[model samples]
Target: MILKTSKEILREITLCDHCLGRQFGKISISTNERRGKVIRNLLNCLNPELSTNFNKQKPCFLCDNIFERAEDIVKNISPDFEFFTFHAGTKIPEEIMKKEEMLKEKYGLQYQESIKQELNRELGKDIGAIIGKEFKREKEDVTILLHPYDSKVEYVINPLFIYGRYNKLVRGIPQTKWFCTRCKGRGCAKCGNTGKMYDVSVEELISELFLKETKGADSSFHGAGREDIDVLMLGNGRPFVLEIKSPKIRDIDLQKLELEVNQINEGKVRISGLCFVEKEIVEKIKNTHMRKTYLAEIDVCLTEEEKRKIEEFFLDRDIYQETPNRVVHRRADKTRIRKVYKVLTSKENCSSLEIYCDGGLYIKELISGDEGRTNPSIAELLGKNIKCVLLNVISIEEKV
Candidate 1:
């Protein structure tokens, strides 16, 4: 620090408060402003004081004159951004950093700090004070941007996520609207340019309404698992997360979203226990299959008396199921052994029964016996064939 004079330094290099201060970064500096001031003050004190006090205003090379207007930049952008927390994203002119490196060759520059870190600290502190929001570094909902030269700042707001559970009361429509398989959503004659197999889906009904109400451009829906279009999902529904892209309003009532979504679906789908959540929860819900219960109306080809044997197999049994023929296209033809958690006879005379157990259990294959793919199935145990007439997801259980 004592090796160079202010006039010599200013003559050799032009440095802003941040750039000059950063050169002494390893000096156990407390704050960016303090470091900037100290570095300049060292030059002023160590060297003879300037006649016109121009040394005090020596511009930072890396940050240009950005440090001179740090407070003004933070103040200018705070009005538009109103969040409980914020973080700064700094951008330094690349040439300025390079120039500092070149000057370091001739003069002794030690313990330096980066102009970017300085701007981040100074702007973050000043903005945090002006608005009572904390600087959330980990998962900030809003980010503050500073253009130190022109004292310009911009704010970026993160997307909002809402979590909820949905129950599909009726069938026929898919969990998510299906794109036309023939056109692959490109809108051929089959899809009529709508590019979908159906007009709308349970997901669309809820997400569309959310986008409208929240003034959001788009919304994405994520569920724990999806049931087939023909299958109905019941009981505690399914955990889902809906991300509102560029949400203009975050204070909307969840109860209202639930009501509006359910109403739009016309009772076709029901939602409950809705709440706002962080984006990370969506991932948890997607992978957590937990446990599920299914109720299927089995159509037995057996006589009434032979159907009675179905109960005996359910008392205690393990069923080996190869991926069913229907899903074989997507899933590998591998065998899986699952236990029957419980069984309830819906109609003894009709030879139909309900089975409850873990999720991902193939119900139709269990009844038809999956062409001998499923061992110890109701059809196999009774020594007669059976088919599932109506399959319904009765409930899904997760750790609340």
Candidate 2:
């Protein structure tokens, strides 16, 4: 029944082997094009008039010979590609697509593939074979857009991720670059035509090195948590991932890059454990619970006995802290409970003491009491006015 139907179709309209075989692709004997050639040969032996009148090499009436251009397109674009995976796509004329639809309806062909899909598949296979790359259906690294006169090859360079810890040494530099409020990154006179509020940032110091090495178009910095602009990030530093976008070069010597970045930005910002990682690590680092240690220097008129009492008050206690008034403009005004696993106090002077507390606990608010917003705070417990002179993140203990 299939062979007879194929011969009848050949007698009625002109179709190449691929188009004819595509009709019976649902049977899955082999490839549709091969099955089409097999059917054509059998029909030629049975009916000489059909073979002479409607040649198998002739342009398909439905597709209009568009599929035959795949090879020439591949060979032409071969010199421009150095990609690993690709997706092929084509734009066919509306009239040709409508004619194909009409033929499908007339022949009651429910199992046939569209000319566009078959064209992409055929071209993708041939191109993949020549380039020694796989044809990807989704998340393609490269995309070949085929049109009648103009064709384009687009490269989708996947983001390169580097996981490490960054130390922000300065007191005034922000973790990320702050664009000018006046122009919003477009150069303006208010920002001195720099398109930035500040000339230097932790993100710029770290990501600039990577952008130069990878030859990437842009970059984004993802930190586990950020410290205030006034606060210094010391000790082991804070966890972060620098996502390099559209990186032409992925293979890099991370150890050497780390050394170069640190040497360039020596006293400003430094990165450690510089290694390549997957994109998912960015989300993981954001969502994961991390325990941190901070060293806060507070100035208060307290004696040795009073400092001991302050240390005893915070140990193994849950500090009910409301959002500080300083950050209320940006953060939601809500009370949150954070655990103080241990509190270490050292008397630097008669008016200064260094205190170490757990992560997520607002150390400055704990000292000042934030106008009675933070409960069981050092200021509230000691009944003394305490002000944080300097705050620094000493360590960040991340869960494996």
Instruction: Give the top-scoring candidate (lDDT).
Output: 2
Model 2: residues with Cα > 4 Å off, grouped in runs: 1-12, 42-57, 78-106, 133-150, 187-190, 332-335, 347-360
Q: In candidate 1, what are the lDDT values of residues 279-365, reduced to their tens digit? A: 889888776555777877765545556545666558646777888888899779888777777676655346556687656678887
Work out how many backbone clashes candidate 1 has: 13
Quote the RMSD, in angstroms, for model 2: 3.4
Q: 12-34 in candidate 2: lDDT tens per residue?
A: 88887778888877777587778
Span of ten consecutive residues with least summed lDDT in model 2: 148-157
Give all TM-scores, in the order shown.
Answer: 0.85, 0.84
Q: Which stretches of candidate 1 lie over 4 Å from their true place?
A: 1-11, 36-58, 75-83, 100-110, 149-155, 301-308, 315-320, 331-337, 347-349, 398-400
